[model samples]
Target: MLAVAWAASGDSHEVRLCVTDKRLVWLRDDAIADRVRALRLAEVDEVVARTGRVRRQGELRVRARTRRRRLRFGEIAPGPLRELAEALAQVLPAGAVRLPAA
Candidate 1:
């Protein structure tokens, strides 16, 4: 899966998320550049989805156990963020599994 996230005000960084069977990569393109920054789902302790006050915009923060390590994707539209977060949770280790409400 691939998706983009950006601030509504267009002030923050824009990011593209690429989800694969073995990795979750974030890409950035600026001044003729393309590279994959791999931060695998297994490395993350949690992926959180947070809503901003205005509406339709939120944040996804990936927290790792390492010191001072975090990957934040903010100003995302809520629906896509939720889907991505849930997908991430499913792929995590068995001890950290998450199930959607039924």
Candidate 2:
């Protein structure tokens, strides 16, 4: 994995973000195997990064060609999320990842 991040779940658990060579995976921290979801890099159309108006926190979502609905990753620190997006850009086609204006 290139980058890993965590977000607090509503149940007080953690939602883990895993960025790997093949895909972006999201799963519960406690249950790494079960209930896992993935978005393949090859199928990704665009990656959108957005920040909250108040806290300056951010989140990432993926628009994939193979899926109708966008895959939403949990909220995380903007710095790490940007790094993750850049890592993805290295593998993905040009203009595949989009970040908010700095």
Winning model by TM-score: 2
- Candidate 2 Cα misplacement greater than 4 A, ranges: 8-13, 30-33
By lDDT, the best candidate is 2
lDDT of 2: 0.76
Candidate 1 lDDT over residue span 5-102, tens digit each: 44221222656765665677776643145444667665778666677776657777777776386667776777776676666666776545332222
Error of 2 at 13 (Å): 6.3
lDDT of 1 at 71: 69
Which 10 residues in a row give candidate 2 its minimum summed lDDT? 5-14
| Residue-by-residue lDDT tens digits, candidate 2, 52-101 | 77887777888889988876765678787787777787778898888765
- Residue 42 shift from truth in candidate 2, angstroms: 0.7
Whole-model lDDT, candidate 1? 0.60
CA lDDT scores, all candidates in order:
0.60, 0.76
